[model samples]
Target chain A: MKLFLYLDRESVVHRLHPVTKLVALPVLFGVAMRLERLETLALLALVVVVVAALGRALDAVAGMASLLLTLLIATTLMWWLFAPQGGLLRDGFQPAALARSAGLGLRLALMVASGIVFLATTRVEDFAHGLRTLGLPYRVAFALTLAFRLVPTFVASGRAVAEAQRARGLDLDHGGLVTRMRRYTPLVVPMFLTSIRRADRLAAALETRGFGSGEKRTDLVEHRFGGRDALAAVLLVGLVAASLWGGELASQPAVQAALGSARAWLEALYAKAASRP
Target chain B: MRQRTRPGVLPGSAESLGVPRAEIARRVAECLGLVGLAGFERREPATLSGGEKQRLAIASVLAMRPSLILLDEPTTDLDPVGKGEVHAILRRLAADGLAVAVIEHETEELLDLDRILHLDAGAVRRDGPPRRLLLEVAELAAAGVEPPVAARASRWLGLAEVVREERFADEVAARGVQVERTGVRPRLATRGEAPVIEVDHLVHRYPLRDQPAVDDVSLAIRPGEFVALLGANGSGKTTLAKHLNGLLPPTSGAVRVAGHDAKKAGTAQLARHVGYVFQDPDHQIFSATVWEEMAFGPRNLGVGEDQLESRILAALEVVGLTEERDRDPFVLTKGQRQRLAVASVLATAPEILVLDEPTTGLDYNDRERMLALLADLHRRGHTVLVITHAMEVVASHCERALVMAGGKLVFDGGIPELFANDEVLARARLRAPTAWRLGRMLGLETLTPEELGAALRGGGGGNGA
Candidate 1:
């Protein structure tokens, strides 16, 4: 089974230092958090798309395309329902609520896209190497790798469990909320226990292989962070700088007016596309 | 299992490590080169073949530069090619003077070892050279270890020694045993009946793979037939089997299972007629008690409350697990857990059973029990399709064999025809089990040890008589 979104493609983004790749994640998350403007979130989404394209990981984006769209539309509509009207839907959809809800929806989608890009660009071994370099303890770094490997094991088991149950005539599709949840109950226990057992097996295998003997281990093939990695790192850092700057820029009146108009224009475009058929 | 591998050659890059980058690369290259994976440093571990992954693990341990290395069942899940690669690498390591101890159930690997330690239930039953220990077939068989084919056949032939295949022909010829190029008994299934499962030009392409997992291949299995699906890993046996139960809808062509159009039908609807048992029982067993696990399938199929108890009981009884009905499934032995998986599927009362490597990782005793259970099911008129790498199982249990390679079904015939076709066997990465080879040497078709023994005693003018 494919372990993660990590595609084994040779590309500029894929060749970046695992640590350098991971640096984008926290930075992206931070930007998404302070982001009030839908346009800024859109910028972050574009950045993710560019990175994904460079990594040859557009497939990852396309693979989860429906889910991402669903999250965007669902989160937007759902948030609009609960948006603080300062009054309710009695007044037409408030621009503030519309902006806030759309930003939230776009923000959620951007965060997931950012994650897809990071995982697609970063290899698990490189992730471990980067974590350990960042002073993540040997055992902790090893544990994280085990966790990464276990994801597929758990997924495979979960699927097998479902298929096995399905073979026994267990159908979860044709049910109400409670009925579906109840139908799913049989899957959870086995999946959980089976995953735990698999985790234990993975850990035991690592232990037997002398995972942490307190001696510094050397990699057989050392990956050199080439000039391209440095340039990619610089670009990622510049993106962070721009996001930080945007946080301060949003306080100005002119920038606020500009961001607000951009948000409204984006929402109108979305509404136009969505309302068609 | 993949945790056995490291980042490759080492755990860290050049800047973080004390060793010079050049030195580390040299070491990595040396180790990987030793294992025949010199050019695979850049390959992602996930994408490597099973045997390649095993080699990477061995190479990681090899890179550690330890004098002593140990492995437990390192080749159990690999194809014959993978197994051969691992054995070759380890033999080279042993020749280079490393103390390599391997805990393996497959007796074939022991032929290359300098010494053999025969263990029975955690106790050392015999510690001797392979030449001596391998010949003790009776004791080895009793200990639940499959004796090397040479040893078992030689013993059956009443030969005193010679436990290697190289000398098997000469040793047998000295006793006037004639070799037969073609000694296969055809056991093809009758073809008048409609197929319980049929696949026509089925193709399945995975999301990221360039090639289809199951290519445009066609086959049919008649009801009440026991069939073996044979292939190396990634050869589409599982993918093709998945189509039979509607777990995977074909990318092209059509699949018909028990008169239902698998492409159009829901998996649950098809599940009523076909039961699938996975390779690992741990993947599916979740109930606290054996009874609950057995009840799961029947309850899903909507067996009436009154008949549910009887259904569960009958399934449990069929697997000989009635005594453990109230026991926690987790506490059961691996073999028992596997049996419970079989019973769980049995509870649904599907007429067609598709088991994926049911006897893998099982000891001889458990294997025999599982085979007996399967025989019983076959006797009760259930169609069985087993996807397996075990040629011994194919030899004795299955009436017909389907061999797949590069996503294509290259051979479909009786088991004897399968063993005889070298081209299909090569493509499928299968080796004829020892019984078949021994049978060929003696000019008598044999599927099991008993069959060989009876044929030998009756045909050979033995002085022991």
Candidate 2:
């Protein structure tokens, strides 16, 4: 029932200030976005792995490993069906294109992994408070955080309604597409009603605590940025700058020769598969 | 984000319009600690119990350290246990010398409060101590407040009903109230030859829980037996009941329902023999009209047109919603919607019915109506299993009681035996019904006020039923 991904862990990354962790997310995403080769992305992936490992967030990363792998394979296959790049294959299904797509997929997966680590490290309260400090409107920040807060509740109620309908003999599994869709009516109506009721209650609960009175609010949580956070922020910005500028280092003559050999090896394997009975 | 409005300057509340962020955080934690919700800081309000939410709401206000706190019907939406929790907190707050006032309808719970202000048509009608105002039965009834059971019973017995439950029991025992004696445990009714539902060594674990939700529970419920599954919240009663209808497959051991392996059989197949009513009626009643709601279950079961009409009509008749067959179900009162939920489940014609907290959030008349409906169903040859915290309802209506604590079946026996086992009752956080206490003090095995009164007045016969 705990569908949220905020893992409770005490680690260096988790202990970092919310703004420190928040800045790391976009910086890490920038590093992943600028790199285009597996060699460079592997180093970036190592950085991610070490960060996640130190943060005790590897379990969550491992949980999504299969999903990331699927995206990698699917993106590579999809790129193979595109027009030939560099004219390396007859139908453009070449290793260069495959490597590009694989790198693109890995970049996306790494971005998502960093986002996951950020979530695992940062509580939703800190995230909202960070936004509030960053000059976002309070209502907008609350709207964003409310989704994270209410999803588990919404899902729990939906599951309850589904179970109730199943008890009443509304079999949704062994039905045709239309029948299944129709059978979901009993579950949907109740979930909708529950959400509305919850909304009404939430409004009253908020109102009673002097919410929407536009009075200045105070919080029990203090997101402090200390010397360690400043150090972390500088290191993250330098890392992003280095990764963006570091892609050219992969195109040096020696690295290009190694890449050519790997591409040749991949082409030979594709030829062998194409010629199979 | 809660606003900071200083009602009074206390340890955490500074006299300022814009409180410091650190101060607010400190005050929030301090208030939560005061209200016994220190570690539940991040829990979703939806996942919290009614009592917990009420406590959280109180903590939100208590952070202000207000000199006087006023609430309107705080326990209205809570169950007996939840109401008890709120009452205890109120008493504690009052005892702490904080001024507290509550607009309450369930007057029995607030007897310990120092004063009562009875309002009639927006005017102060009666202002006195709880002992005086609550005992004026006629005026109390006219004021639309349910006087405590001890007060009503004492009035009927011609004793000065100026009594709390403890005093009533002491007074009745002091009067040398004679009582009829039978076996130590009341005689259980003759049950069916075979149990319709059987759970053997069932252990249920959620994906993330450290301990099993239902740990090694084993019990059987026979046909035509009105059994109460009593437990504190999250004590595995609902988890055990879910196994009966094949909604939850046990992680270990086996559950057999009516001679069929529940784990192997599909839930739809199990629905043919057992129907489940959820705690909230809105979860099940989805149709626009009452008639359609009644027909939904039977239609799902593939009841032919030849029999579907009669089945739906029979169900509506049984739950007494026949006249509102075409009315929109959403427009019905909560009590009627609850009955509609029962009717919808009954439309499937299951022999065994399991209701989860059916009497919660109901007025006295609706609660009685629901109990009468269950009793009627039991009479018509249905095995009824009710998962509830209402000890009084269990004592009066159920033939047997199954008490659970910490996911273990602590006690399974007759009502009086369950109450007499103080350890089990304490483990389950259950209080015995007032009638049971009064009757026990009077040396009888009665479960209802009528029965207890009759036995106490010496009705010229022995009482055991």
Candidate 3:
């Protein structure tokens, strides 16, 4: 209920270069994208779960997983109800379709799971530093930091304004739409005015500190991409190669012939159930 | 007095009201006492004036009844009467066994405080009662807090001491530094050159306010004139200032900077002539490096790269922020950040300067430095306009003063004359300077400490001294 999931310590996952993590997450998703069999996708999901545990991001993963499960169950049920391949007899509910649904669900869940692990382990400042290292304009990087700082500030201001409004006895809870919007006028005006004023002050403060005339500037904190970055990149490349190879094998004539036979058998069973009358 | 009880109040009701523990009745009573709002029972806090609202915030906290209440520069935005009233309440709270912890930069008021906790670079530099700490003027300087009045006066007289409150009366008597009868005319500076800013029939109405913030106000400020604007909160000082540099447009009035119409010229164009330093520094700093941040305005104006560096260096020199050029603005103390804001604006090299509540949230040393910087600017012939509730700043620096109330200018005259008129100032919710107060006590009409000093040295008046 409190929704506190951003707590973690320095670990192997945390130390990996953010760019490498960014690249690796998509590669993992691509692997899931190529896999059609439910069992193989489930195995991939299991790997994600293992990685999440190793990264000490299990709590975050669990929260995402629960959300994924709810969506997956609802979507699968809806798909099954009007799936076009469904039969009238209750006894003849095809297991293959259910397997297919499981495959899709596993694929989607694993892709989301990997993303959660990556973000939970990363620090915002490191991400900004990484942007700068990757040749982003310095202004953009600093602006991102300022924007991030502004979020908490804006939230705090919002709370302060809300408290001020409540003290004034402006009841926001039981108001009409127009009244609610009107009540917000006072709060919004002050927030905007204060933010502008703050911006002005911040500008002056920054200028007075010799912010713009740097012959040379020093960074108080440093970020480095070490051995972990190399290892992670290598592993990601290997996974992509393995996934392509697996896709090639799955697309072979022999594999296709076997999958076709299984579909044919399910069709015959449905035909028999329809002919029961 | 029997403590009144509320029937079945919520567990954290006091906290919800921005006060922690006292009963609702006591909270209301405290608010009423502070604001002089009587004959109201169970009235919501939202209907109070800006000053009243601030007091209510303080009273709400008082109700929570903490043994030690931490107030962060509570009087920064308040006028004299409101500030005085709040101070009275705080004094009462202290007397009632509350260990009040106040972090403030106002030096004159420091004399009345019980204890002063001086911090420097995140470390406690000094912790003692005000009287004892006042004597360590040098040490206080190092800690970036201003010395008390007598200490400052002593410095002017070539005698400084580490004074504590118990010795205040004896030391002043012994020093033979005359406590002057107030109201004397020091040499006034000649207003030079043409008007740098001119406004005629200025009217500005914020979308929210029922009436215009600035109503048909006409004024002109010449170069090298130190002008101060005084008013109650929301009386349109800031609104009028925003129009000076084209940040805001007058609804039905004309604002011209050096004969160029501000509204017609646009903000970017007017920015070249009138450099506006915001009250807060964070809004304008959009760069990772301090060097880059300072270059923004100049870069926008298309100053040559070669010249930009020199200008920035000069600006930094003025504010004394040259050493921390690379440090993140976020990491600096509030006072330091404010100075940085000033330096950034100065880097652009505008002719006229408009500052809105520039001293708010600053510690004493920061305020003094800012005042000194303004004084230096005045000496350099830059037209400066400041909006503040602080009569001390007005007294120390300003020659001319403008008082506004209900979005109208009530009085506009010389600072001495303005403060000497009690009726006009009271109507505007502004207090006369401390010197003026002392001078009035001595039946003198002077507005500043220097004038009072002169009057006393000449043996020119009353038994009040």
Candidate 4:
């Protein structure tokens, strides 16, 4: 994984304070999980896509689309096969079962999409800074930032170890699942050793740099919540409220009738496919 | 008044330290400018090149306004250009009244500093001016330090001690030493045989980057040839080396190793013919004992148990690690670990050896021992390709030199030809070996100090000074 997910772009979503973005992720996740109707879940997914587009993060979304698509397919299939609320449609087409699985799948996809948007818009340093501003200890915030920074370092080290092993004729590709995993197990030893050595050096470097020298640390960049950030927070709170109440509204008679019509249309399409020669 | 410079403090946070933000900004800018990274404020530290990262590290320290800055081998893994840049920065810092102390192994470059402290076994063996101590050849050799080439040449010619190249040349001219204009021609390996490794118009672009790391580069290495690959940081030396061993398949074009297509063959198959030794030995050594480390390659190749012992023993003997076979590899010295890394590859019995900066962090003796081992391998008919920044190693060891610049093969020829070509050197950001530079100034051609001394002594005339 990349160390930093921040895409350099000028957009309203990117301009929001990082704390607002952090708050929006959990709020969106909460709403996504609580909403039961397929239409509400689809609407949440659309909202996430729109936010990603506003942040100029479509490219990142496109890059992750294949992985996300795989997740969507896997989740949809698992839910269709194993969901307790729906029975397996072995005898004939079951529109209610299909709708239930699709709703769960769409809800999961929306949660992941919202997370991607938040990561893409917020810089790692900004996240740490926001955490510090929210009363996290400076040491804890710095450690969190350093962990993010070390992700790339560890990745590069892991690659080096793999390459080194490959050069030594350790065949990692042509093997059974168990055999391949066993081949990779040795790599962990060297990687861990290298990380330990690097940590030692980094500790020395940090100590020499007065990391814990008893001075109150200062931030180079200060973020303040401006009018736009306040607006974003209010919009986020309103969305959360809607998500909490939207489930009851969707169960109302008029909404149920609309969903029933949509379900009939989907069932007809499924039947047509089932009737094909 | 007393001043304290806290290490690891962010240069950007001068405001919370009761300093004005504008003053912090000015200080940061000045420090960055001093380190030659003026416009890289927003660049991630991880994204910077090794040299640039070291410079940035120094810049951060400089931001603290430290009176005395101590750096431990700041140029350990940097390319020659990077090393020179860091040295230049240190010189400037020292000139600006900041006491700069650096722990480095490449003392020849550090000879220009105010004083020299020669240490051996963690004890000071000599302390004096660089000119006096560096020229004391026997004393330095006893102390396990490699004296400057100029000093060695001066001693060989029975002249007074001279450490600097320009001073050595001036002394030679003043004494009216007749240089025979003879140059040392390296023994070029026979070229009639089919090339063992062939790269045809190779191009490798990383997934995220717009441009290729290894551009349209083509080269062929014949059997038993010793070649040096020279380039600055991010100039594609390592990328090109990776292609030879199938560690990295080309994005376009072809790479053939020992008649096998690198792109089609797995890395294991390529490992049988081209053994790649990485820069850091720690990345490869995981086994507890040296014997197990040596046996890893052959074991991976599925060598018979009967032959595995023999192969490990023979490889250990080659690297002179037989005495340390039972010891844990982690406990071995840095030099021993590097030798073990080579021995591990040697057990696979590959014909072509690709080493990426083997002498990077080794002390004088260890570096010499490693080069001697390579020389021994070359004598055993192994085709050796070394990626290195040490011009002296190229001058004394490799028969041919390939220079890369911006991912393209800019120059390929004999080492002397490479040294004499100023344009290629400038493009590649490489300096000629010290003796060769002195020879150029004196209207002669030479690659090593012994050759320069022989030329002054009017030895046999046909390019063997």
Per-residue error for B232 in candidate 2, Å, reads 0.8
**Lowest-lDDT window of 10 residues in candidate 1 chain A?**
A83-92
Model 1 C-alpha lDDT per residue in residues A1-277, reported as the tens digit of each score: 4557877677888777777777768877887887778887888778878878888999988888998999999998877876656223545667777777888999988889878877887777778878877788866876686678666656767888888777777888897898899888778877888767766786675665556555566543236667877887788778778877857777899999999999999999999999999
Worst 10 residues of 1 chain B by lDDT: B1-10
Chain A accuracy of model 2 expressed as TM-score: 0.83
lDDT of 3: 0.68
Clash pairs detected, candidate 2: A84-A92, A219-B25, A220-B25
Task: Evaluate chain B of model 3: give its TM-score.
Answer: 0.79
- Local accuracy of candidate 4 as per-residue lDDT tens digits, A1-277: 3456668567888777778787778888888888877887888888888899989998887878887788878788887877665646453447777787788888887787777778788777777877887789977988887898788899999999999999999997787899888787659889999999999998887766667666665566556677888888888888888887766777999999999999999999999999999
Model 2 per-residue lDDT tens digits across residues A1-277? 5676777667888778777787678878877878888778888899999989988999988877898888777766665555356433445445776677777778888888888888887777678767877788877877777788778778878888998899998888886899888888998899999889999997776655556655566544465677778888887877877786555766888988999999999999999999999
Residue range B9-102, candidate 4, lDDT tens digits: 3463343344455566678778889999877766667777889889988988777777899999998888777788899999999999999988
Best by DockQ: 2
Distance from true position, residue A74, model 2, in Å?
A: 2.9
On a 0 to 1 TM-score scale, where does candidate 1 land against the true structure?
0.85
Off by over 4 Å in 4: A1-3, A89-92, A176-179, A247-277, B1-22, B154-164, B183-190, B459-465
User: What's the candidate order when arranged by decreasing TM-score?
Assistant: 4, 2, 1, 3
Q: Name the TM-score of candidate 4.
A: 0.92
Candidate 3 docking category? incorrect
